[model samples]
Target: MNYQWYPGHMTKARRMMQENIKLIDLIIEVVDARIPLSSRNPDIDELGKNKARMILLNKSDLADERENEKWQEYFTQKGFHVVKMNAKSGAGVKNVLPVIMEACKEKIERDKQRGIKNRPIRAMVVGIPNVGKSTFINAFAGKACAKTGNKPGVTKGKQWIRINKNVELLDTPGILWPKFEDQSVGAKLAMIGSMNDQILNLEELSLELLGYLHKCYEGILAQRYELEESEDRLAMLSAVAKNRNCLKKGNELDYAKASNILLEEFRNGKIGRITLEQA
Candidate 1:
């Protein structure tokens, strides 16, 4: 299967970010805890080069707990103030303000010396689609300030929201680069439902997902579907189909229904707290 990310309005989003970067003092980047590095757009590093940076590992609740800690350490070692959070439930939300203050402490001190007081820190929130940028903003602000959906490209334009008297947020649409340098990254993004499902070949994608789960997380399928052992990924998917009662008119397995179930369960953490990559 070819893992292609349709660019959509990403080019325009990049332009908007470039135009607004200078007006920003800090960047609050959100990434999926399951695919931290893959979910990150490389353009952000260039766009936010001179600014203070923070990495919010959104949806950390759905990822492997041990891996989440490692990801926090990994990003911290690279000079980003990191927070592991679940934006939907607002878990770990309270930790954000203190860390934001710490990340922008230098700028705050500089402003104090320049006779500026109570100047809110302007931060640009960024991430690839479906990494939960809008949800994070809503949770952080304790209100529905930005629109959020399960799939990608929900946010279409920029919105500036005051998170507090000390910090304000600039919300930008999620953007992915035109081409994925590693096709695996694209595949991972697709598995996480970051891409539009209408254009994808779900059966092929489910097979790939089955292969990964059988390798990295053995017994997961057996436990979830109560299936006997099968080395073949397609066979495992068939078992999922039978277990899910996804049968067609002729009693043949509905691979498409099984595929959707597998992918959706994986995304929603029903398969377990699994991480796609290691730090």
Candidate 2:
């Protein structure tokens, strides 16, 4: 399935980000741990150019541990203050403040030299849709200042949240580009629940996911559904439908139901700690 989702509100969101980018001192970008690169909006890099960058690898618990480490190193090498965090459970959330200080160290030093004391770091939190920007904000602030949802497009507008005396956060809506240059990036984003599921073909998407799991994580489906593993993705999905009793009124295997189950399980990490993209 060809994946593309750019809601009309995103244009306004992009404009808002551009207008506010100049006022921010640091760019605190949240990205999905399972698909770090794909979950990022390329526009953020341009918008945050020459700004202090801190990357929170949100939902780290759902991603492959080894791959998460590799991605951390990758972003670190690229000069991002990286932290692995599961925002839902607040795991590794305590590390954010210190790293924020670290990322904006020069600014703090300059402020101190100018006799400016306790100048709070102004950070713009950005990410692609459903990458946990609001959840991270809530976790970092230790309060629910923004709305949180399992689906994408939760934050409709920007909200300034005072995190602490040391930090003030500008929380913006998650933004995707006008078009994906590489469709694979779109597909990966869709699989991670960044795209609207209502507009997607789940069965086709599931086949693609099944193909990957069978190739990289063989025997996982068999273990989860108690069915024989197969190189054929369609056969495996069918088996999953039958084994899980996903059926229509006439006892026909319901591939749609099976597809939703598989995607939901994978998205929730019930299948395993799998990374759609490797660093």
Candidate 3:
């Protein structure tokens, strides 16, 4: 299992991010809670040097609660303000305001020291696409919020959504690329449906998923699909196909159809609330 990310796209995004980063006080980064490390692009640390950072573990409702706690502790230990949230449902959204204030306390105090009053903490929401950035922005900004248009000497056509008196969020989110150096990381990203499916072998990918579930979460197969769990990965997949009646024109069992069904079920949480990785 090998993977390659678009360096050209990343380079362009980095340049744009560098240009936009100077105008902001904090970087609110979002990552999928199921594959926290894999979904993150490490270049953000260098790009956002000396800036206050907050990590929102998005889509936490589908992940293991215990692992989510461990991940929060891990990020906090490294000096990042971490929040577990389900951006789609707006769960845990209320907690972000105080954490934002906490993350940018120094900047807020600096404004007061300089006789600057009522200055909102400017922030940019950043993340890899499909990690719930748009959904979060909608939830965070809500219906009644106003967009502060471009000001004199500011970047042309820049707009900010005033999210209350204490904070104003950038209308656009900074896009980051996924890490594809490690094969395992790539596999994990694929399993979570973050990567493009066109480049993947669905049957092979399904087997890899089965392997992980068999190890991390035993008996999930027997319970969900009514298939016998076996040490042989292909045999388990065949059983799944047989149980689901995934067949082709000649009445032959179609592993590809079964693979698609399995992956889709897992991705949409039809199988269950399962997390692919652990602490």
Candidate 4:
């Protein structure tokens, strides 16, 4: 699918991030563990060029365990301090504090050298829409400091959350890049609910998701829907509709209803701990 979603607020958020990046010592970038590379905004590297970087693989509870390990290694090799976490449940959230200090060790040491002591480390949480940035902030801060939502564009402005005496967090609104040149990246993001659902064709999106799952994770559909898989994704979807009783007024299969069920179950990990992309 040809996918492009750049709302006006996201443009304003990007500009705000560019302006605020200079004030923070570290960039705590949150990415979906299921599609780490696709969920990242490429412009962040340019905007946060000189700052210390930390990659949080948020919502890791829904991703493949082995893939999470691989992604952690991948980012760590690229000079980023990585942490895999489920922000909603606060799993692995404790590890983030020490990792933040470690990531900004140089800056901390510089402050000590310049006789600027007892200053908290400044950090900013950033990510693409629906990547769990707000949830991570609330979990890491051990309070409901930032607003949390499942949909994209919940955070409209920036808020500085002081976590403790030693740390402070700047929470910014989720931002998407101006455009997606790679269709695969856009598809992956859409599959993971990073895009606005109102603008998408759910049936088409579910079909694409089924195609990927059938290829990479065999037997998942059969196990979940209790139907024999087929080479044709639409046929499999039809079977899913029949088994799930997704019928219309005339007792005909409701493909759209079935599609919504499939996408919702997959997103909530009821289908399985599946990862759409690999490191």
Candidate 5:
């Protein structure tokens, strides 16, 4: 799966992010827990340089626990405050508040020293689409928060949601473009449902996913779809089709319908909390 991203959109997103960076104290970057490295935008390093940074390994509920720990350590070693979370369910979200304050401790102390007291730490949530930014905000703020509407010169209608006395978050998440030049990166994103479904070959993607599950997870396919363990990837796909009764008008196996079933099941966690990538 290859993505054709226009440079014009990239330029605009970059420009908008640069402008927003100046008005915030911390950058809350959300990345898919399954492919933490691949899901991240490389340009974030440049854009967030000299700013306090925190990495939320969102959707941690669906990722492998061991891989999640490794990814947390990986990003922390690189000077990013890392937290593993299930943004949809708000699991591991409460831990984020303390981490957020810790990430911006220096800035908070600076403000205190200059006699600027009672000011909440300003934060902006940013990530590529479908990484669950809106869900996170909604979960974090609940129903008690107020939207501070329209700051001058900061995009005419941008609203800020006061998370608490100590933290205020920008209501809108900054959109970042993924690095789609790497074919593996694109494939991983597509497997995780971040890419557009119309352009993908479902059968091909399902086969690739099956190959990964057989190699990394082992016996997952056998347990889920009641298939014989085999080294051949296509054989496993065929077995899945056969078990699920995916067939055509002439009683031929319908590989495409089976492929859709496989991918959808994986996405909805019917395949059982499988993560596509590891450390």
Candidate 6:
């Protein structure tokens, strides 16, 4: 399915990022571990040029462990300091600060040489919507310094949070590109709850997800739904609906309900530690 979502606030958010990017010494980019490349907004490379960069693979607990390692290596090869983390439970969060210092060692030494002592390293957290920027900030800061929400666009403005004497964080709203030129990227974002569900066709999306799972993660559906996988994706969804007892008053299968259940389970990691994209 083809997809595109660009809200008005995102335009403003982009402008805000451009205005505020120059104030920070580092850019902390968070990407969903399941779909790291798809979740990344390439504009950040241009927006954050010449700044220290760190890639936090958030929600790593839900992604395939092997894929996480590959993604870490992929980004490291491109010179980004990478950390795999689950911001919700604060797992792997402790490594972030030290990695940030290491990534910006040159800048820190320059400050010392110029005698600019005690300047806190300024970093701005940025990512596409629902990739867990606010959660990361709260976890990293050891407090709820920013508002956290499961829905996209929870962070509407900019707020600087001081994590410690030596580091400060500027939290910005998640910004998606104005257009998704590749439809696969949009689909992956939608699967990860980065897009508004009201505007999507859940049943069709579920079918797409089922097809992907059947191909890449073969026994997931069989294990989760207790039904044999089928070549026809719709047939597999029907089996899931029957197994889950999603039915209407007339005893017709409620495909929509079944679809929602499947999507939610996958997003919550009930299906397993599955990664949608590979390095």
Please name the candidate that would achieve the greatest lDDT relative to the true structure: 6
Candidate 4 vs. truth: CA RMSD? 0.8
Judge candidate 5 against the unseen true structure and give its global Cα lDDT, from 0 to 1: 0.78
Residue 173 lDDT in candidate 6: 90
RMSD of each: 0.9, 0.9, 5.3, 0.8, 4.6, 0.7
- The residue pairs that clash in candidate 2, if any, are none
Clashing pairs in 3: none
Q: Which wins on TM-score, candidate 4 or candidate 5?
A: 4
Please provide TM-scores, in order, for all candidate models, with all chains considered together: 0.98, 0.98, 0.89, 0.98, 0.89, 0.99
**lDDT, each prediction:** 0.93, 0.93, 0.78, 0.92, 0.78, 0.94
lDDT of model 1 at position 161 = 99
Off by over 4 Å in 1: none
- Badly placed stretches (over 4 Å) of model 4 are none
Model 6 global lDDT (CA atoms, 0 to 1): 0.94
Cα lDDT of model 1 by residue, 71-157, tens digit: 999999999999999999999999999999999999999999999999999999999999999999999999999999987999999
lDDT tens per residue, model 2, 1-279 = 778999999999999999999999999999999999998889899999999999999999999999999999999999999999999999999999999999999999999999999989999999989989999889989888999999899899999999989999999998999999999898889898999999999999999999988888888888898878777889999998998799999998999999999999999999999999999
The per-prediction tally of clashing pairs is 0, 0, 0, 0, 0, 0
Cα error, residue 117 of model 6, in Å, equals: 0.3
